[model samples]
Target: MDDDIPTRMFYAGRRWQVTDMPTRIRDSVWATEPGTGRGFYGWRFQATDETGESFVFDVYPGAEGWHVHHCYA
Candidate 1:
């Protein structure tokens, strides 16, 4: 997993700039079903923006690339 990477995201109809490098908060692997198939890996992060607001974000690998799953300010 990549750490301390700068990223940008569009949320709530606005673009949020990740002012600082993102820090990994947690990591997890979960199965698609109950002991049925291969699982997926994901990560959570915490970042602070230029406005001094802290935000929580998540990212996961996909067909395209690492996608920003969600964020909370």
Candidate 2:
């Protein structure tokens, strides 16, 4: 992450560019991965492909790196 912000990503055989400002999401009710206390859970942002298809993604950091937790098309 560049300064803890998401800019672009490649997923589903296509490159996606973040179209809107990213918002950090915190989970106080659930335990965060790789940490004991509540901390940075993930990021929520809208992205678009070259074909102009857009999706909202929820991504989180893990021991293996970043992961796409969910996506809303």
- lDDT by residue (1-73, candidate 1, tens digit) is 3353546655455555665556553333455565665655555656555565767777766897766677776
Clashes of each: 0, 0
Candidate 1, residue 65: how far the Cα is off, in Å: 0.7
Off by over 4 Å in 1: 1-29
Report lDDT (CA) for all predictions: 0.59, 0.86
TM-score of 2: 0.81
TM-scores vs. true structure, each candidate: 0.49, 0.81
The reply for model 2, stretches above 4 Å from the true place, is 29-40
Give the lDDT of residue 14 in candidate 2.
94
Best by TM-score: 2
* Candidate with the greatest lDDT versus the true structure: 2
